[model samples]
Target: MNALQFIETSIEDGIGYIFLNRPKQLNALNRKMVREIVTSMEAFDLDPQVKVILLTGNGKAFSAGADIDEMANDNPINLELTNQFADWDRISLVKKPVIGAVKSFVFGGGFELALSCDFLIAASDTQFSFPEVTLGVMPGAGGTQRLTKLVGKMKALEWILSAERINAKTALQYGFINKIVAPELLMEESVDFARKIAKQPPLAVRLIKESVNKAVDLSLYEGMQFERKNFYILFASEDQKEGMKAFIEKRKPKFTGG
Candidate 1:
């Protein structure tokens, strides 16, 4: 794995952190940056040592959106050849739990990125929007599909069409962001939360995330069947046996991602 220029990555105590590093650009998603992000996610997801993946930015804004400067070219041939949006889609396929630690601005593509995560902990001052309508295009990523599934049709339509910004409070009220913390506590709280999740039985955690995500696209009956199958399969894992034994023994279970 080569060092990434557009993103900073580190793993500590079972948690992997991927920070958007282009502070000068408000951590905007460009081709290079998005590719680096997808690469980092793939690496972390495959690493048995990493139990959870935490994503955030190093600047005032999580990201202002896609690199509008590059979007201005409007070359369809170039866009297809680059396969830009496909790389962004790869983030969703990562099987590990992903948590978003957001602050300031999370707009357009940035908003979609956050939605891709299993959950998000955001700063109270965070501002989210999908301003692609104003750009004469729509969110080319999964924003339209994910946002509608998340916040309902009316709210999704209002935000996407109007391109208005919603503060963290509103976003939480609308059931998107999981929690809001003071800006100073953002990183600490997010990491602490990730660490707590990292302490869980790894196989159970991954299956839980996978099952819930599948529920989004599946009918209630189908989803329940899938959930039941996953639940049954976990009983066959060593971690599950240890977890149950620990409960009976009144001790913390040491899970080795088995």
Candidate 2:
């Protein structure tokens, strides 16, 4: 927040962009870097201009993993006292649609960070893994929980326990990622997708995001109840009326986030 040493934030059109800045270290997430990312997203959530947030790394790899040098000498007491993993949870609290446009390597904490986004678009060459077991550590930042929900318990166990890297194609087949573009198309396709979402009815988009995320934590019946409540609540919004009216009129709906 104070100078953004580990990350860079920007706003373009209606998208809030966060670029992991430590390319030389493959954007390895240190405590400070993760904090910077969460703080930037918090700021963007408050800003009216930012309708969507796209996260990408500055260089080839999205992120290699956590900074080994920073935590190798740490103990459990210090770890709990620091509560580093808590920062990862903050990402889910963000209201807007968050899209991860990751490339090359996304491993360990990096893979956890990607899963924190509402969805991901990765490069065809990207390789994802939770290689923490190799280091005698395991994912501490919702990686186990989220990956299990997305890819199922068996696949999660296969990948995490085996410490095997998952290619983009296999990841898409498992439904862990939304899409895979060529390495050259990663940014362009990411922005194109973000821009399309940005043009939608903002309030509806926000509510639907909340509803879908609830599907992950709530039982099927409870999730449907939540979705129904949101659907009814949208009837009170001006955009809801405009969207329907525009449909009847066969014209584009103009949304003002009302």
Best by lDDT, which number? 2
Candidate 1 structure lDDT: 0.93
Candidate lDDT values, in order:
0.93, 0.95
How many angstroms is residue 147 displaced in model 1 relative to the true structure, after the best TM-score fit? 0.6
Best by TM-score: 2
Tens digit per residue, CA lDDT, model 1, 58-174: 989898899999889869899899888889778989999999999999999999999989989999999999999987999988999999999999999999999999999999999
Q: In model 1, how large is the Cα lDDT of residue 103? A: 97
Q: Candidate 1: which stretches are off by over 4 Å?
A: none
Tens-place lDDT per residue, model 2, 1-258, is: 479999999999999999999999999999999999999999999999999999999998999999999999999999999999888889989999999999999999999999999879999999999999999989999988999998789999999999999999999999989999999999999999999999998999999999999998999999999999999999999999999999999999888888
Backbone clashes in model 1, listed as residue pairs:
none
